[model samples]
Target: MERTVYEEETYVGLVVRESKISVNSSLEQDDNQLDFDLKIIAENTGDMLIIASYSNNTMGENEAVNESVDISNLFKANIAFRYFNGMVFSCSVYDFYDQMPLEAKIEFTMTKRISSSVTNKDKWEMFCVFLDETRSTWSDAGMVTTSYSLDQVSCYSEHLTSFSVLMKVTTDNVSVENSETLSLMSTVCV
Candidate 1:
């Protein structure tokens, strides 16, 4: 068996959705637009991770401080999503180092197929898996890689016939090391 370690230093704050118009009709004319309005609500669930490292110092009799360091660790965060039955279609990650009010965003899309009977109030479930870089006996050495998965369920509601979804991952941190230190990985269905 192989041991896979999760990188928690990456954080996903929230997923947001927007609406885009495919077609429109006016006086003897037709047009289309891609627009989205952010909605705020509760009652959704997702997962997140926080990876960090820290150092400790001890005072010695020689009037000097002894420092101790530990390897980076992972912390998991539970996230709630408003919709269910959606998978991670795409993803992008950005990093800002040594900057105040640090922030980043992950944008992805999702789709689900189900019967024509689902509603907004109906609950659904989805799964997301993130893989970190590591070595495996099955492959050669000196390979740095990462990947993630998104799973979603359908809410068969009578009010809606079809649903197309987009997901956004945003984060804000006061402590960041450097910009251009971010990476992204994604999985999509053809």
Candidate 2:
């Protein structure tokens, strides 16, 4: 999620929260190289989030967004979890010809905030979770979090659904970026 990157960035943009009535940025066919790499975080939950992007070549088109949602009252929130973040993803990709969502590989990275106590590696207990549509429940995304780097934890994603990168916390105070402030344009790398 830093400015420095070493991969071929096929599609990169503002990660937004996906809902029933969806509006997302579509990755297009292009030959030019976009030279920007980005990283963002969840405001309230204190979870620093990063995105690892890819191009779904077999797919005619795919829809996704990195969105953050903050609630004023956790007592009334729908998700019954001890830890949850605004870093949610809507991963509904359509077949170029069939209009169905296909399973694909995705990943997330979290950078350690140097000055913040919450980001302390010793005190943090974090995990990634995805929402199950039929049961309306949040379950573990079954992804692996590896601290291969000294300052980041990247998790692997394997399916199409809504995803959240969460962290355990003892306080209710948190901040999230407003949806209106985000731009959906994507960045590609050479």
Candidate 3:
């Protein structure tokens, strides 16, 4: 039994420009019926369109997210990001009812701008957290408390310089409806 050929794991460089940024349900449905999507594959020239992934979907029918709505009249929660040079990383969602429950806390922070020539090489920094809550206004209530936490950073051959990586993503107790929409999407590769 001698016939073996194994060669897997290939990433050949040079991805010039690939762009896609979205916030849906027709761009927040005139201020409600919310839906959001943000995708900007790559742009080697760099000015922050390097995000290859970002998704948050909560459209309709899939209700079962316990009851804890009323995120303080639900308005004023924007988490923005645009780095690479154009520089624009944002944050908001200030204590949304303290994140719900008796000691709830859902705070999504942002500020990630790392381009010291790929933080020194062999690079991979990924942070993805997406949770679409529902209950359709508590019709059958029993689920909405969403939770998320994931962080991965690796930059081998160290010699890093350019930095600004403080991307905190947190979530707890998410029962949304009343024009439900809590969205965020981020997938970047530079």
Candidate 4:
């Protein structure tokens, strides 16, 4: 019983490339369908393809997970265990050399950058917080599902680990290349 192959590192830009492909970690469709999809195929590195999917539905009673490292069922709600009401890291960035398909989101924010006389900026809003390093505390990540199009931004995670997207910046001259928040991270060569 030896099947050990786990690697994940995908960062596009600034030259850090390594593409490996391997799929089928209990590839679910039905039969309880507690999906934990991980698709990391960044091979050849042309045509620019970026896709990340980690899902769940929750159903646990026996307890024994290790399908290439299963993060249980994340979190939907927890009584003792059996969690999974949300978890989706959907990212899509297809730039066939500026063919256009770049608006994929992965924002982790601490929010700070507003100085143009501070005009309120229509009450800025952007939230997706969850950082409970054991007990440091920072709640509210019960996002069952969130979707958006015109480039793509689908954040559906009831719980994971290390999360931040809490932005409430009052618009005013916020420059830094539009506040400079662009992310695309991946790690999976397992």
Candidate 5:
């Protein structure tokens, strides 16, 4: 038996993070542990990656059968990153070729610009979002669009000024594929 294969493109929605930074401070505390948790959201876009696998079979007169299987599919996801400096980073569609059958996850880290006079007391916060396509009407539209309220932060003290933001993304079942099948029939008369 033979099978037909097809590829389809999908679009994912936007992911949003409430807050990217958390801080703790005490007047009389000598030692403290700061916990920073960031939220990440991924949208479902039709433009995901997909792969296909198939096998072929053959039969011989000696009542023996042989089979061969191979992979024959590939897909890519395009992601764009925007920074606070009005700078944008573009990631091209990467092939979803892996040993394990799972989705692809992409992570990004950004460094915050700080002045030399800044000290430890000063606090800094940053966040990031992704967009599918570029928009010409508005600069923000080109971006996946992060909330200002979510990306906002206040400096605790003037001592701390320099900081950086790291963004992580995970996608599930983005790549899909089908397997091929083959059948053989043989007869012998003595």
Candidate 6:
């Protein structure tokens, strides 16, 4: 699965929607600070992942991070596949109602669907992104290969019990700057 985006950004509120997350940084301005735009999209073959970010200050906030993970052991730790990098960012709006910082939150959601098979073999595949934080953009860092193991097929009585996908989330704000790594695996048998 893949996500397609255009340069135009719209106001979608503080929470990110399902399937796609949009961040509108162009509306904010700072005379002494450098300006930047942040966007993120996550996709999968049989499921969906959602991530949302918010700010802790009244003036709002901006973040940038890079994440990467490896899960090739499912098909025998083959270097040809099972590893990827993705970019993530979140923003929080300033609320004048009470005058205290709103705690930052990151949300992730996964929805299930039927698995896809190739040539009568069930294969799990995911297309992810890698970010160049220096420029705040996505790039194709490598190619991914997929295969099924004979032992993996024979073990669960010819049924695959679990499948995994890689995800990375990062934040580069002064208050909190760090990278988040995750390996998302589905235990649903297929």
Q: Tell how far residue 90 is off in model 2, in angstroms.
A: 1.9
lDDT of each: 0.20, 0.36, 0.21, 0.30, 0.22, 0.24
Clashes of each: 26, 11, 11, 8, 24, 3
**lDDT by residue for model 3 (39-115), tens:** 32222222221111111223211221223222222232331121212111111111112232111112222222334
Tell how far residue 2 is off in model 5, in angstroms: 37
- Flag regions of model 2 displaced more than 4 Å: 1-85, 110-122, 148-152, 170-190
Off by over 4 Å in 3: 1-45, 52-60, 68-70, 74-190
lDDT tens per residue, model 5, 1-190: 1222322222111211112122111111011111222111223222222222111112211221111111112121211112233222222221223222222222323222423332343332233333222321112111221222222312111111122121211123232221111111112221
Worst lDDT 10-window in candidate 1? 25-34
lDDT of 2 by residue, 1-190 (tens): 2222223344434333322122213222133111112221112222222222323222121111112223222322212123222234444433333344434555555343222434333333445566666656555646555432333345665565555445533333222232212222222221
lDDT of 4 by residue, 1-190 (tens): 1123222332111111123222222212222122222233333344443333333313231221112121223321111211122222233434446545433223321212322332444333333445445655434446422532222223434333433232233334444443332211112322
Mind sharing the TM-score for model 4? 0.21
Which structure is stronger by lDDT: 1 or 3? Answer: 3
In terms of lDDT, which candidate is strongest? Answer: 2
Off by over 4 Å in 1: 1-90, 93-103, 107-109, 114-125, 135-190
Candidate 6 regions off by >4 Å? 1-101, 105-107, 112-190
> Candidates' TM-scores?
0.17, 0.39, 0.15, 0.21, 0.20, 0.20
Candidate 3, run of 10 with poorest lDDT: 155-164
Task: Indicate the TM-score of model 3.
Answer: 0.15
Error of 6 at 137 (Å): 11
**All candidates in order of lDDT, best leading:** 2, 4, 6, 5, 3, 1
